[model samples]
Target: MVLLFAALSATTQAQVTATIAQAGFGDLRPSDGFLVQHLQHGPVSIGELADKLGITAQGVSKTVIEMERKGYVTRTASSGDQRRRLVELTSRGWEAIYASRRARAEVNRQLRASLGPGAPAFLDQIHHLAEATGAVTLLTERRLRP
Candidate 1:
């Protein structure tokens, strides 16, 4: 279990670094990528982002402020609720997301190649464990801390 955890951690860190470089988003962190992915679907209110990220509204606001300064995202008053601020990705943010996706795909391809014939079964077992532990839901719904 320790070995598995170490391997996954190392791989994740390397993949994140590679994704950031490939995306030319050195200013963004992995958490930023996760946050922006949510906005890829559509604009979301700050409160909703806080809930989805399992963070405080103030924390989300701080992140939004930084991202806004970087021009990766924009927050505007909601049409229906003037008090609620909706966050959406900018053109640069979309480009970063697309590049990150491509980078991650390449990393997955390399990982599979390294695993060779055992890749499919290994992946299935990993998914099984994740599902059994409810990690799948957590991964999809919230930002995972390393």
Candidate 2:
């Protein structure tokens, strides 16, 4: 019974993630997702994004190069380090990410409404109950593969 529930939850989450990813916010991929996440903290080294995304720096660099061509990101020499470059969103990129976030929020709102007001509290309980076995950890620890 427990395993069945586990499988069901995992399958549901996987499907949800797939659906969200496919939405793609109409871009190549959510490379902007990582950029927006880091940009909140300030500039990030191009190298840092590759590491955080868990892809080869070469892969990340290639994607960034493409995004640069698309004007989704701008790579400028780091103010303090000429040898390094910092990646940042252009105005259009900011617009793109904000649009993506709004899209996700709408999905979340729909989910919450479907689940009812108790859903958030119930989810917290589920997390607590699943703690030692790390069932929910899989959601957070998911390492996307290319």
Candidate 3:
């Protein structure tokens, strides 16, 4: 029974992960989308981005490197603090961010359409599950909560 439950749990997690991956824009991961969203407002230091995303500075650096290589972001020396580097999205990055938002919207539309009148309830349950599972940060959970 325990083994069967474990298998089921892994399968469910894989399905959820696949759904999220498919909902993202192009090859951008969720972390990339978060970085792009923050950069859309203004330039931010890698440390600050890491703080907001609750990730390690090294993780942010790796993602920034990938984003820079992809022409989605640029790392420049901060005028205010030469020791620190600021990350700003390029025009391509802005386009990618917008596309990500659209893709997420489309996913939501499809979910709602599929769920029909039960969509809200289904989303509420999902939100609760996410909170319980610590799938997102407390800050993100608060933002998603009513």
Candidate 4:
């Protein structure tokens, strides 16, 4: 179990490193990716982003400010309520997301090639373990800590 945990942690770190390196988005952090992923469906408020990221609104605001400066996101007043601000991805933000997806897809392709015939079963087992351990629920709820 300890070895498995260590391996998972190491794999996750490697994947993140690879994705970030290949993303070509200067200064974009992993946490930023998580924040922006939530906005893929549509624009959301900072409070909503904080809720989804399981972080404080202040923290989300700090990150959002940086992202906005980087031209990845934009915050605008909501049409319904001028007092409320909605956050949405800019074209550059969407490009970053696509680049990260491509990087991950490449990583998965390599893993699948290495696993050969056993890849599907291995992936299924991993999914089963995640579900059994309730990791899937935590992931879906966006409650996992960075």
Per-model CA lDDT versus the true structure: 0.84, 0.66, 0.72, 0.84
Ranking by lDDT: 4, 1, 3, 2
Off by over 4 Å in 1: 142-146
Question: What 10-residue stretch in candidate 3 is worst by lDDT?
Answer: 137-146
My TM-score estimates for the predictions, one after another, are 0.88, 0.65, 0.64, 0.86
lDDT tens readout by residue for model 3, 1-146? 65975685566444544555564534655546666667867899999988877789998999999999978899999998798999998987877766655655665676589789988897898788767877566545332221
| Position 11, candidate 3: lDDT | 60
Per residue, candidate 4 scores C-alpha lDDT tens digits across 16-45 of 566766667757876677898788898999
- Quote the lDDT for 113 in model 1: 96
TM-score of candidate 2 versus the correct structure, residues matched by position: 0.65
Pitting candidate 3 against candidate 4, the one with the higher TM-score is 4
lDDT by residue for model 2 over 24-99, one digit each (tens)?
5355454345545655556678788777777777877787788888777788998788989888877767766666
Clashes of each: 0, 0, 0, 0
Task: Kindly give the stretch of ten consecutive residues in candidate 4 with the minimal lDDT sum.
Answer: 17-26
Q: Quick one: best TM-score, which candidate?
A: 1
